[model samples]
Target: MPRMLPPGVGRRLRKGERIVLETHYHKTGRPEKDEGAEVALYFAKEPVEKMLHVHMLANVFLRIPPGSREHKVTASYTVPLDVTAYDVMPHMHLLGRRIAVTATFPDGRVQDLVRIEDWDFAWQETYQFKEPLRLPKGTKLRLEAVYDNSA
Candidate 1:
């Protein structure tokens, strides 16, 4: 788990469900031997009222020309049902400088879910909101990012 959840909240898991873990090993320049690893699973002691789910938003298509700076990338998604979002995580690779996620309600109300004016790929982490947002149906999510391809 990247971050611990608050009490009474946990990842949804059904009875008799088996968790499949995936591991990625990188090649080192020098000779290396395999080391042992382990993972721990913790369940919520209290009844779970809310489940945490991760949804990734990404734009794979890009056409950044050589020596381009401030390249803009955008993507959006609409919610079909009501949801309460308590955490958000925005990711970008090298050359990314800015990113912002916003929500526009049906009634023309706008809310900033997450915004990073100075994006650093090394400082990626989940952001826990102090107050969970009640995103009603028909909420539109918009993501805009700026990348520097000047190199």
Candidate 2:
């Protein structure tokens, strides 16, 4: 006979749950430019544990055409998580403006994990949740970040 499994081992994320986030910039878009931008993540509002070195990730630079209203980029990764309070943030160069983390469920229900309207690459920090979030096995976490590459 097969061994019995633990309870709640494969449940989906429920309402009022919290999550932690770890982010890193693939690379510095402008290595020669000293006046560009820098990004990093922090835990517990402190710049120490779980910090990701930005240069380890890929980076790209672009010059948007005038009168252009479209620029899109996507990065995907799986975060190993347990039931705990957490926050999400995206680290980017000067172009970063907004960051959105969404949790999609198998039942089609979507949850806004976290959002930062004004993204400051200098003050990059992952705002932790006041409460721990419980995520079920079927939970699908996604991140969407918007940037303003124009200087």
Candidate 3:
């Protein structure tokens, strides 16, 4: 996912700075073949006022029955600091059927971040919001994912 820095923060890679990158690939039953992958980086022409941050929402302890058609898993995290959310990414395996992410304010107001009623593993993507979502401290971010494990 790519994001532009919000307007007075300037980020520069210092000399000898170490950057870590991670990638995941699906395995097919066929023999290995040569494949190409690349990552592109863009720099802003001027300085920005706010820095962009990526927050990962994940559920790692998913366990579904062999014939389950609508197994569900939920995870939540509380915001430790005030932040502006600019994008969302939902990740799942082939069994995933639906997913949703939402935010509950401390005052009891609820806001939908993103929702996918029909999830396709092949078309997974990151959705950028038209306008940044302002999340105050103490807001709870909840994620619910549904999966189908039937043969």
Candidate 4:
């Protein structure tokens, strides 16, 4: 079933409550960069407090060749409240082998939100957190995803 939003969710996203999606790619031995990584953050039909799901969309395009060395791609977003389990997953091309998510708080407490070690590019599935992870107010939600670009 589609979710229903509360009174003032959109205003939050538009009013800087929404975190800008960022991408970072690391090349084997060379300097790290954000060459061709793509990141998309989508809100559920309802706000984080109302909906049972938070849709996260991530993608990466490797500018370098496939077989030189493995590369890592990362994407992140932020929510108004400390997030508690709303379907999280990473999206990548045929080179993607693993995806992991980490939520870091302002106090430096880190939580492993989700991890997909042996992901297949052909079959992408929505990852559900075992339990809802709660973040307190004034917390900065950090989600980091890694991708492998290998032949």
TM-score of each: 0.77, 0.48, 0.80, 0.50
For each candidate, the alpha-carbon lDDT, in order, equals: 0.84, 0.52, 0.83, 0.54
For model 3, residues 1-151, the per-residue Cα lDDT tens digits are 5545555544666689987776666557788675856776677777666766567887777788899999999999999999888778898879999999999998999998999999988656778888978899999999999999997
lDDT of 2 by residue, 41-81 (tens): 22233233332221111224534455433455554433344
- What would the per-residue lDDT of candidate 4 be over residues 1-151, giving only the tens digit for each residue? 2332344333234554656645433346777654665555546565444434554534344354556445666556655665445455566655666667776676778777667677666545555555545666555544444444454
Q: State, as a TM-score between 0 and 1, how close model 2 is to the true structure.
A: 0.48
Residue range 25-123, candidate 1, lDDT tens digits: 555778977895678878788899878877677687866777989899998889888888888888777888999999999889999999999998764
Candidate RMSDs in Å, in order, are: 3.9, 14.1, 3.3, 11.6
Task: Show how many residue pairs clash in every candidate, following the order shown.
Answer: 0, 13, 5, 0
Question: lDDT at 58 for candidate 3?
Answer: 79
Ranking by TM-score: 3, 1, 4, 2
For candidate 4, the per-residue lDDT at 85 reads: 54
